[model samples]
Target chain A: MQQIINFFIKNSTKLLFLLLLVISFGLIIQTHTFHQSSFISSANGVTGYVYENVNNFKEYMHLKTENDALVLENAYLKSIAYNNTSVKDSVEIKNLMPAERQEYSIIVAKVIRNTFNTKENYLTIKGGDKQGIQSDMGVINSNGVIGIIEKTSKNYSTVQSILNVKSKINAKIKGSNHFGTLQWDGKNTGYVNLSDIPRLAEIYKGDTIVTGGISKIFPENIPIGVIEKAYTNETSNYFTISVRLFNDMTNLGYIYVIKNKDIEEINQLEAETKDE
Target chain B: MNSVAFSNIARFIALLIAQILIFNNIDLFGFINPFPYILFIILFPTDNNKPIFYLASFTLGIIVDMFENSGGIHAAASLILAFARPSILKFSFGISYQYHNLNIIKKVTKDIFTSLEVFGYITISVVIHHIVLFGLEFFRFNFIWEILLRTILTTVTTLLTCILILYLIKPSKK
Candidate 1:
């Protein structure tokens, strides 16, 4: 027993380092696995509070630009509202009527902290469980698709920005049923790669891309980006296309968190099918 | 001794706040993030209380990770840096590192260390930190080029910023 004590005393510094290293690696695993229980995320209260105060101060600097964006968005929304026949012709009107029945609702939130330089970027916004924001909800600003919420505390949530290398979203070319997976290469902040797009689908450099909506997270046909480049690879038959995002992700301000009301129903039905 | 401990605590908090608020947001030349916060680990006393130094480094890394929303990559890198500090000091300071009271910042201000020794120390430390940080972040051998590019770019940026900070806050000669 004394020998073991002596061994520990002799190597305590190394032991302590190994112990801390193990804990840090465990945290990395937990965080990467998409588990919701991790404690060290920005969604936690103390960091969230600090970011909120900083955001409150920083918001003043961007007030003029923010107002200009709001006015532009308001004009666009008003144009849609005035064109009654055009609004009725859209797919959203069809979904709102009978079968789908308003499955998605938007909750307004302010971006408290945003980072895009890292390989895995995240945004902390000023709404959480208290504001009906939850994990895995789609987040977007007025311009276009932004990201998905990954964690939430009492008054804040952290979003897995589309710029993150780990981010994968279902996207489709506008006006066609062809679907692809949107992912970031951690290279340019303004671009994302859309893969698994079949070879036969017609595409152009400026063709618009929109959300596929196959998942319960985002509504269908929300604008994502325009194709910046596309080419077929020798290794695979599918085309790898580069998309330029509509939103200037580096300059985000306010955003909307989408809550899908039919998520529980869809998940239960899928689980039941899998079990069968 | 108490005042030394207190000043260390103050420096820790100050560097962390500066990192999370200003440095992280700088977005220099559009993507180079200067993480001078490792200065906490760099400037820590090289005397006794080795275990406390390791713990403090881990705590600083974890807190920075919390603010950045990166899972423990910062913690792992900072811990590695802290564990490797003694060898780094020995290599940079040569024979002078045998003295327990050797202070890099003080010695630099007092001209005990030539600018090359100080530069080498900061360069080695910052490069190691960035390599470990970006390596775990990319987490793929195929991204070795990306990792190397980022490591070099961020190291240069961080080294310049750290040296400037060292000059700004070097302790006065008694």
Candidate 2:
């Protein structure tokens, strides 16, 4: 016991210095935005590399479930194709509208690192600038909307998950044309809040919410979530609605990146209008 | 309480207030703020327990960090300064350090060193502390030139302020 005390007394400065240094670093990364981002990106690269290997093994283990999903998607696509051809055959009798060319293209990417526990959660994807993935692009899965791209490195990119506190996307009811800002309250992982909705719009529980397409980042009518609950304050004329998200944000795997080809033109036109 | 402990406690409060309220807010040419609070660590009694010294320095640094909203950069830099204080004293004083083993802390305060030696000691400690503080704050290598320039400019300002304070509060030999 005496020996242990003596040793500690002799080298206490070095030990204390190390301990304090670590604590300081933790505080620095937590409080500062720039430091937080740089630390997260570097940490993302290392952790993403490790997760990729682990995900590969997990993917193999869940092969049967993945196969079933793919089969269902194939069946859905076949039925849509058949319906389109049948409609084309009756176009001569009924005045048919011409189909518009698609303005958005999707690039498939795998999530390597995803976090749902924090107030500001982000996901790391395997595709980056090299794969034409840029900042401000929208990310989605087959089921629903995910988030917008935040930053891209050489071979990896980070997406600001809709679960983040700083996230705000334009969303509206399916048929009512009532729009509001969608945001996460950082309480429940499965639910988000839609605020600034007008009290005059008729909204009910289980009403579908989709992207409002007010911004060029996401296309219109992308499924966001379903209304769980809604209320309006006595003093305020807007309703704050609770929405249950369609995506299980915590268990994400594959996602698609949406690139709008007309985004630049749209932005330029908006800028010109604003200048007037 | 003993005079040494009383003086140290008084100095800690005084320095912390000056650092947080005055020095932290003074931004000369946008980035040349001098940190005079480091004088507490520089003049900390050498005969004191090393662990206590480290803890005090870290606490002082954290308090300054909180006021500045700079996270932990100040705490980390001050801890490093405390750890390197002994070597700095040894290098600057040389044989005089061993000669005054009975009261090494007092000896350093009273010794009439040359201006160059005083300048060198202060320069080394201030430069190193600023480098670590700014390096961790920026945490990026792309702005290497900016970091170097800021470190040099801040070190010179801090060194002057510390040296002036040391001279003003010169320790009288008993």
Candidate 3:
């Protein structure tokens, strides 16, 4: 027993090194597999506070661009409001039906820290559970889709950017019902790849890609990007198309976190179906 | 000794700010981030308490990882480098490193070794750090090419930046 103690004392440094390595590897595995790097994430109070201060100081430089985007979005929203008023007048009685109400809510937020260079990129944005932000909510800008909220702290959240290799959002051609998965290959900041798009669908360069209805997280027909290139190998029945995102993901400021009001019901239904 | 402790603490804070604020934002070629932050592990005084070195390195790495949202890749890589630093020092400096008085940055300032040895030491340290970093990040054999490409490109940038910073902060030859 004394020899064992002596041995441990002799190799304590090596043992400590191995123990720390194990802890770090444990963190890596936990983060990658379960997406639960909560306490260590930048969304925590201290990092969030730091990023917020930096962003507050830096936010002025982006005001011109942010205002322009807001203006464009305002114009679009105004147009929609006008159209909706006309439709409401045409079907005043139909508007009373609870089943036809809007099912998504938008929570406006500003991105404090954004990184697109990493293999698995994440964005730290202002506002979190305090503002009703939650994990799995879809984040978007006036331009297009951004990413899903992966983890949320009380006052901040981290978004899994669409540029992340782990990100796979359900998307489809603007006019077609055929669906594909939009993913990043960790190569280009300007583009992402849309795969699993079957060959039977007539596709062309410049074809617009948008979020499909299949996802409960995002509303159907939310613009994603335009197809820059599409091709297929002889062995495969799918066409892999490259999409050019409208949002210059490298520079982001204001964004909207989408909350699906019917998500609980939809998820419960899906889970029940799976069990059956 | 007190000054050494103070400077080490100051370096820890200064490098963290430089890395998190300045270097992290500089993503050349859309992917390569110059990680001069590892200079902390590299330039930490030799013959210091080993367990304290390990813990300090891990803390620095984990903080960087938290900011970067890269899980524990940085911590793991930094720990490995910290664990292997003695061997690396020995390899670079030879028998001279065994002495308690050896300080790497001070030696560089004193011109005790050729530039080649300095370059070699930094390169080896940076390469090992980045390989484990990008390799664990991608975490797949299929991404071996991507891993290598990122490691090489990032290492060159990091090495250049680290050397520049080293010279910029080297103690005056009194």
Candidate 4:
């Protein structure tokens, strides 16, 4: 009614501000870690669909670069399959006595948007649900592991970039067998920090880091990075080791997202054991 | 009800399309993502009711959310900027500047204080948006330092991109 209009006109700015503030705060709360509302994920779907197409076009632009990566990785993989058994032996060999080994299928896909500079860095891949791409598939470049697939639509998937704080990969030193978790400081592009390496172990600089194979997420022996610096912190028992990542995470064009065929089985077993 | 209002709406839709679809998806340098859709907010018709303006900004953010499928982070961030716009205006400019329906063109070219105030408002909003968006995305306080660095660098690039677009269009600044 005219009364409503008059009332609105009287305190329009204040009311509008309050309304927006409420909606925004609602969204923030809805998106907050404490509250896992379905709204944010649904909105991500809309945003995802739109970006999906745009990523398609932009990914096309990087076709040549991605093509180069695919070709190179293919050649290297082919050589490993045919000639280099010793190098490949360590990766394929499984330890029955140890934790479950995940068998992963690596598929080469183009990177559309690989934003490493941002705190919550994400990488978009050309493959998606149609390609059998699923969430939690490990993403890696030629030199090392990069990220994990967080979401999947029809023809595209978004990988939670290694730069993301939410992302972690179980990793360890190649020879020393010092196991730790690799996580980004959310700062540097090519550098991430290794946490939980026991202080008692004699750690050294320049040690090559590889996936720990502890969890069934990634296959063991996948290269992650090289230790740039190692120092024990007084505050914590874990040695804080800086890793200079082998893959140029910032310039990634094409990466192979590895799907571990055994993850479900292993997870099922783990869940059963934990429940017991 | 002038066609200019409709034209502005169309412009907003088009720019947003270009921004999320074209600009944001680009891996220009890995970490540097410069979203230019905020220009829509800076260019929104000021003749409408303030609450309606907030709704419009929220809708704009919803559109972005729909495409990114990131829940309501964009809407959340845009609404915050829209809410903060008035306070930013008051704080940056003197008491006199708040009273009049200032001319957008004159504010840009003739008034240096107006220009600075406008720029200042945008810079703060951009920073605030990134902080909230990234912070919520992580959903944790453990990576605070990484979040800070990313916010600062991305904000710098976004600010530069905003200024570049503004200078290019040279829209009558309000």
Query: Taking the candidates in order, what DockQ does each have?
Result: 0.72, 0.17, 0.72, 0.43
How much DockQ does model 4 earn? 0.43
Q: Could you give the CAPRI-style class of model 2?
A: incorrect
lDDT of prediction 1: 0.88
Candidate 4 runs further than 4 Å off? A1-75, A82-102, B21-35, B62-73, B87-167, B170-174
Model 3: per-residue Cα lDDT over A1-276, one tens digit each: 999999999999889999999999998988777754545789989999989988898899989988988899999999999999999777776556376576988999999999987778899999999999999999999999999999999999999999988889999999889999999988888999999999999998888999999998899999989989998999999999999999999889989999998898989998999999
For B1-174, candidate 4 gives per-residue lDDT tens digits of 777678678867887877776666555556556777876766554454567678878888777764454556777677777766666656655555545775443354244335677777677778877887677656567877767876787788888877776666554536
Error of 3 at A13 (Å): 0.3
DockQ order, best first, reads 1, 3, 4, 2
> How many Å off is the CA of A66 in candidate 4?
4.5
Q: Candidate 3's fnat?
A: 0.70
Q: Which residue pairs come into collision in candidate 3?
A: none
Pairs of colliding residues, candidate 2: none
Q: Lowest summed lDDT over 10 consecutive residues: which window, candidate 2 chain A?
A: A35-44
Chain B TM-score of every predicted model = 0.91, 0.88, 0.93, 0.84
Worst 10 residues of 3 chain A by lDDT: A93-102
Error of 1 at B80 (Å): 1.0
Ranking according to lDDT, highest score first: 3, 1, 2, 4
